[model samples]
Target: MSASYAIADCLTMLGRNLKRLRRYPSLTVMLLAVPIVFLLLFVYVFGETLGAGLGDAGRAGYLRYVLPGIVLMTVASGAQGTAIAVATDLTQGIIARFRTMAIFRPAILTGHVVGAVLQTMLIVVAVVAVAVLIGFRSGASVWEWLAATGLVALTAFAMTWLSVAMGLVSKTVEGASNLPLPLVFLPFLGSGFVPTGSMPTALRWFAEYQPFTPIMETLRGLLLGTAIGHHGAGAVAWCLALSALGYAWARRSFNRERS
Candidate 1:
């Protein structure tokens, strides 16, 4: 297929997915509530204790510290919705109907991925807005804010692809919905809520080395003007690796003959 033709087909699929998102607002509301709830709970309930530990201004400091992780969690939490959407399409005979059409085959998957990324980014903006309203201040300049947004979009892209693959392989929508839970909770195991140095040696090791740690650290550096050091490179590497793996896996599964 010509590149333009494939692009057109992808756009069509993207429209379909977006319309579905609008038609069913409950899923988006549920996906969005999780991060906001966590954001509020941590900042209000644990902020004073955690901020004292960091030797910063009480709740205000904790808000800044936790916002980046909450932003990331926003992206990860959206994965469940994406997986469920993909699974629904796969199981509903939509894929078979599309296969018989003249549209580019990959557009079906591409639509879901693009639509998910857009939805996730929108939630990211909402989450950041809520954070700012709740005393989460940032020292990032316009350029730094732009960079942080780019990094977030990249993270969302990688995560949505992985969720697409998960959805493709699942036998049921429930399984697809459950498959991405690990992604949602991964931040807790990282430096998301607290400094990794405070954890036990083993956990600290894992927290420091995991992909989300570097990604969170990079976001902190960009938004709060902390030291990014090697984390910028590490975050980019992890995003690229995950995107490639997910794309390959999703394509393979999507193209396989259905029994």
Candidate 2:
């Protein structure tokens, strides 16, 4: 089929999955609450204690500084849910049924990825809103805000693809459930909570050089409307590279399952 037709079919499948997800109202509510809990816990508990130089700014400024990372953590955590849901479909043989339908070979997988992205986007937005209510503000213009949101959505998209691949590969629900933690751990190694300068020499260098630091730096800069950090270019490159790698891997895995 033509690419356009395939995309359309995928979108239709995406809508169906969205409905399926929405049917679990309690799950949806829980998903919404997860970020809120994290936002409160960290903002209240460690916000003041987190950074050395943080002031009236108080926990509030520091909270703004940390919001993007929390947003990312929120996305990372939600993708584990995606992995579990996908694994459920696989273990129950629904994935096999969908494969047989021949609607579009990759459509079902696309649907799941799209839905995960949508779910994470909503989660991110809700978390951001919560941040605002708790005293976050942005002086960014329409375009800057759009750019920041785009980066977040794209970051979530890459993560969702990674989750899809994990779901496909994992034999057990627990395997799928636990897979995301390691990926999430990588960010904490960077400038997410602490300044890279404060870390040990080797760790500071590594943390400053990693993907999440730059991405976080970029988001913080753009959202908070500061300059991209020293490593911003590297971060953008890393994100795009990761997204490409994730897309290719997910496509390969889906094709293998179909075959």
Candidate 3:
């Protein structure tokens, strides 16, 4: 297809997925609810205790520290829904039908990625609004805010592609749902909930080197005005590498299944 035609085709498929999302408002609400609940639970329930460990920073400081991590965690949680949706389409033979059509092959995956990214962005905004209501604040300038938004969008795009790969490889919807759980929990292993320095030697090393740590650190810096150091570059690298890997795997698996 020509470039414009390809773009149009992807947009048309994206609209179809979005309509499905609209028809299942309850699913979307549930997907969004988990992160909001976690945000409230951590900020209120665990904030004071966790903040106490930071000495003078206190619970309020902890809120600022953890918001970036929670935002990423929300994206990770939404990835599971993307995986499940893809798996459902496959199991229901929707993808097979699409493959038999005259449409651009990649457009199917592009539609899923675009639709999921948009949905995840909406959820992130809602979570951020809730965070603000509960006293979360950021000192980020307009440029910093734009940069942070771009990072979040990159993260969402990478994770959505990874989720698509997971869905393509899974035998069933339940399996697809289960596969992306690790993405949601990966933040906890990094610097999301607490500083890595406080952990034991091996765990701390792993935490510091993991993908989520740099991304979380970069976000913390952009939003809270903390030092970004090398993390900004690290986060970009990780997102690009993962996106490439996921896209390759997803396309290969999709073609294999269709064949």
Error of 1 at 130 (Å): 0.4
Per-model TM-score on C-alpha atoms: 0.98, 0.91, 0.98
Q: Write down the lDDT that model 3 would get.
A: 0.92
lDDT of 3 by residue, 1-259 (tens): 7889888889999999999999988778987899888878887899889998878677788888888888989899889999999999999999999999988889999999999999999999998998888888998999999999999999999999999999999999999999999999989999999999999999999999988999999999999898999999999999999999999999999989988
In the range 1-259, model 1's lDDT, one tens digit per residue, is 9999999999999999999999999999998898999999999999999989998668898999998899889999898899999999989989889999998989999999999999999999999999989877887899999999999999999999999999999989999999999998889999999999999999999999988999999999999998999999999999999999999989889888343
Better of 1 and 2 by TM-score: 1
Q: Give me the runs in candidate 2 sitting further than 4 Å from their true place.
A: 2-5
The order by descending lDDT is 1, 3, 2
Cα-based RMSD of the predictions, in order? 1.0, 2.0, 0.9
Worst 10 residues of 1 by lDDT: 250-259
Query: What's the TM for model 3?
Result: 0.98
